[model samples]
Target chain A: MTATLDRPTAAATGSVVGAWRAVWLRVEGRWTWYRRHWTASLLASGLQPVLFLAAMGIGFGSQVRPGPLTDGVPYLAYVAPTILVSGLITVGVTEAGLPVLSGFKWKQDYWAVASSPVSSGQLFGAELVWIALRLTFGAAVYLVVAAVAGGWTSAGALLVPPIAILAGVACAAPVMAFAATTKGDGHVFAAVNRFVVMPMTLFAGTFFPVERLPLPVRPLAWISPLWHGNELVRGAALGGLRWWPALGHLAVLVALLVVGIALGRRAFQRRLVV
Target chain B: MRSDEAIISGTGLVKRFADFEAVRGIDFQVRRGEAFGFLGPNGAGKSSTMRMVSCMSPRSGGELRVLGMDPDRKGPAIRARIGVVPQQDNLDLELTVRQNLQVYGRYFGLTRKEVRAKAVELMEFARLTDRADHDVQPLSGGMKRRLTIARALVNDPEVLLLDEPTTGLDPQARHLLWEKLFQLKQRGVTLIITTHYMDEAEQLCDRLVVMDGGKIVAEGSPAELITRYATREVLELRFPPGDQHAAVDKVRDLAERVEVLPDRLLLYTEDGDAATTRAHDRGVRPISTLVRRSSLEDVFLRLTGRTLVD
Candidate 1:
């Protein structure tokens, strides 16, 4: 013990490499836990999205014709890309809420990490990095399953997975901020799922075009990141994506992501550093 | 093992919550390789002081230096060399017992090979080698506590801060933990422990401070505090509930001081057996009587006029 105590660890140096090493170690902690429980997470993040794609894109799309709303692509092709992004919205909301709060109040792993050399900002960055990785992996699995089910119409569909990942993180970051403010009680997350997440997924132009809805309710889709994500993905997959609307969608998602990251970082710092 | 050099020091340290002060202005220093303790009851700010020293909480309006570095600025560097065992065991339940140690070592940026080797050594030291592969959630209270301590040592820290390390453990478990801490002290790790248990302070600390209402009432070694604040021995006499006050008046002049409890009257003196004899000769009869050596509890009672544990 005396010999080991004389040898300083990397964090004792307080160098940039040491800071990034702390972040990577935190990510490794999450990965170590995920290794044992990947089966359940795979079911939620991967299989569920593919199942939704099969059920809605094939089973339901057979009844619909190529209409102006779908830009003359097959209904399966149109619905596949939107479901990919919307499925991630559900995954993002689920991942961000209870787990973040549990890390603070119940399991208290965040507090455990807090006492270590790791700073709160570094922990926040590691959490988002891990979330982004999970979204990327899940999107890849969903896209492969969709291609097997005859959902891909063009090589342009490769762009949808990256777009889905951006939107998933955009939704997750702000919800993580809300979770950090909650006390141990999980009822608020249930309300978020019931009142906010469910409605947003349903009306975010995922199932049908927002144009078919009443005039007054159209702004609801316009304000949703998921709706923008759905538009960008569907447009790119079917080869009709225009430049100006694409940039607008990109800007909306990026703005949400930047704002969400800022709030999430501050919330984690306030909750943990105290 | 003690030193004249102070490894940790604070000057008029204060900690304020939003509307309440948890640690009022107080000053103390800890020498290297010594078992130092903060003895107080609940809400006495012992834990707050420990947090400040561990770099987990910032002091509100005072200077605190741990290992000659400012905690507010050099927190990560200082924390990298210190281990904290919080009041509660916050072990990672997602990992096995061994992984808990390994992963905690990684937080300090230790290499995977180093943590793997360190985990095995610590598992043996904590007596958890048999339970190494088992999940942390199913371990008993004592095992979890031992593992928490072992995790704190993953960095081979120079100082270990234990906040109420044995609050909820059974007696046998507590003795086991004390032995482990004693070993650490022998190996030259500076220990700063906060506990409400007087006997634990007596057994572990070479020097300590008695805190009440977030202020230091007395500071000395266990024997020195007993000599300074209290008599060498104490005589306890328990009568029927209402008769203790009458007994206190009868034994008032026979001892240095007398404390009247609802059920018992205490006589503070240099010789407990002699005091019991003198009181018996004075015709102060009681249901039960005993003579004992004075302890830290007696010193705390004398200093603050209150018991150390509620």
Candidate 2:
């Protein structure tokens, strides 16, 4: 009896370590799922962005081109940052709200994770990191396609990648916090996409310059992370940075990222530990 | 909290959900490495108590300590040492079986390399090594449950909590699950399960508590409870409609106890054969006679005064 009693004590530490390794395994597993049915992810994230680049870059770029939207450059270069930033936004928003909720309600995955040694903060943090990595993949794809389409300039355009990532985090961070508290009939996520996402996409200058909007509407654009990403990525592409405003904009993104992280941690504990 | 001793201890445990009281008040201890069960029909509040022990839901009234620590104050610490198999599979349908184990391991902060090694080990343990790479959505129900168990053990918890682990499964699946649970118990993993099926309670639980209307009706080993609360043998008689009462009076003196119902007559006694013989000697013949040993179902019925909800 004594010998048997001592066995579980020895196994406890090993189990703790084992539980810690489980989070990334979830992401690796998701990769295989995506590979087998690549079209599903492709339709939602990859091909849709590619099509946006084609339609907006070629079709929409035609009207604004040989003019001044790109300041004598091509229209593709003008909208490239917007597409990249918008790409990140879509990932963060979709991943944080509906997908996270699915983990709670549809699948027992979150409960399974919670039952392990893992803290709610760790789970939330890991998911956000995974979401960030996914955004990078999507943005990189858009950037490569943009460069291949004769839209490349100086190496400074590399700024679009991080800016795009920031935009996605900016949009996703607060929404993730909000999603943890929501308990409606679930169709509310659709409304968020329509009202929140669509307006951010349109007014935050996905297709045009925010400066072109009326003064009152521009403030709404200013509040959006898409605008900052649009500003930074567009600035880097066309070499148009006002040092103070650009620095200020980056700081806001960083601040929001921190707030999102803090809020996500609190929300996860509240929902999971309940 | 030792492996061979009680790891979970509770005193005056009570759980209340607003105006309703799910677990009004109760106290139980689960020794390490024993297959303990909370057997009850629906609304018996078994699930509610389970939620408290799991550290998922807060205890409304009493003190609950698993692994010798209060879950309310040290939630993560307690959960870290426990493995939980919820009533549902809850496996990530979007991932492969291997990924499910790995991701669950990562939530506890395991390194990538360690998670990989552990995933392989768990898949083998779950008997799903061949299906390790297959999507979870396509696995059979039995396979899913095996995976869920495998996922729960990813952390090698000190106490394993399973709520109605075999509820919806077919007999073959339930038996397979029982076999797996038996192996866990053999390895000295403390098990706490809740089940409505008395047969499952008999087969898996070493000791269990019978619950009805949110209170414990009885608690003991399967054999002890059956003997204490039920007859040693049960005689079931089916008669052609209106003749059951006449047959009942003739057999009433043959047994220690008798219960008459709309469908059948049950004679409770120490010797069913002797009782049947005496009934026959009295020329009270029935359409059918079934003699069998008393089981946990009979005990549950005796204690609860109600049939289980399917």
Candidate 3:
């Protein structure tokens, strides 16, 4: 009892160090869970990307001809960076979907955390930071595998992983905001995957260029974070993207990331604080 | 803080939801080093009041102070100094039993070394040292409740608030939990418990408030409440179907009060044996008769005109 009385009130003190320490504790919880379950995630985020690089770049590359649509490069090199970008978008959507839902509804772990010294906004911020770190690590592994498979045509391909992280979090933040507001079982997540995630992955120019699609459906690709992500990755890896167009893509991804985080933080407070 | 000051106090405290009011305006104070309770039925706003006191929910209207701080302004700080065990078990099912304690301690800003030591100590206190590495999902109901209580103690909080701590446990488990709570009280950790069990209130709380329909109907110690609102003994008589109403009129003049139920008639009086004799003298025949001391259950019945558990 004396120890309790003598302890400093870090939560009320409101220092920068104390605030960051609160958020770091929540991130450690995610890291602990990941340490125990890394193998399953490695299979999905790591090995699966290499297999797609092999099947689409090597096996399917044999029939494709290098032309204006291919950026005059081989199919393997052409598809490698964009596939890495697309894979991370998928990872972001996966991370933001059922896991966020379980934290609020199924497991109610968010309420448990809310009862502690950590605030609801801090919990949401910590989640975004953890996802960004996970996406960075997964992107590094895919880059190594892509390099070994001769997926890059230039030295600038090394810059693609960081850009992939931006797009990944850009995709994760809004999805996390949506998950925080929803209730009940995970059928809504399935609908998000089918109607939202899959369409962006397929039509956002992962397998082919967006110009190949009909004019009416082309604007759908323009609005997707995956398309902006693909443009940046393709330019960085293949070395033909101009500076002005690259800035436009960067701005889009950043706006999406910022807006998603704001919405997610508000939703978290509504669900957990009450 | 002085020992004489109220550890917690609420004056005209009210909690209103969007469409309905949960805790109507009420006032209460809890002194240091004492066990306090909110005794009521399921929807009597006990949990709502507990939530407000725990700093988890904002008060709709009124003044509340915990540890001399306003909950709305200092929620995180107030929450840091107090422990909370919610109605349901919200253990992290993904973590092991030991990991659950260690990780939860980190939320309170404990060092890794401190959390490690605290985890070992708390696991022993909860009697969960043997199952330290097991996941929380497979634990029994009793083990889960014990673990929840142990987790709440990680920060060595000044006040521990438990909402229906032993609601679904068996008799053996309930007794074990009661013993643990008694030990905590002995160590001078202020305990605030909300429960519907009359025996639990009698066994744990030094003073309690009886709540009904979002209002406190009465407030006193268990013996004081039973002595004031009820007679010394209750005489219960079982009769045939539809015969209780007839027996009520015949025995109405014998006791202080007569309560009719579907299966039996209760006669409240100073002496149950004398009441039974007077009913017998009135030519009223009962199939069975029982005499017992008045309890908190009888007090609740007298105040609310209903049973506590029904």
Name the lDDT value of residue A3 in candidate 2: 33
Clashing residue pairs for model 1: none
Q: Give the DockQ (2 decimals) of all models.
A: 0.45, 0.34, 0.41
Q: Cα miss at A189, model 1 (Å)? A: 0.9
In candidate 1 the C-alpha lDDT for residue A152 amounts to 96
Interface-residue RMSD per candidate?
Answer: 4.2, 5.1, 5.2
DockQ-best of 1 and 3: 1
Q: Candidate 3: where is the Cα deviation over 4 Å? A: A1-17
Model 2: DockQ vs. true structure: 0.34
TM-score of chain A of each: 0.93, 0.89, 0.92
Which has the higher DockQ value, candidate number 2 or candidate number 3?
3
- Candidates 1 and 3 compared by TM-score, better number: 1
Compose the digit string of candidate 2's lDDT tens values, residues A129-176.
777877877877877888898676768778888888887877787778
In order of listing, the candidates' clash counts read 0, 20, 0
- Interface RMSD after interface superposition, model 2: 5.1
- lDDT for A83 in candidate 3 is 87
lDDT, each prediction: 0.87, 0.79, 0.87
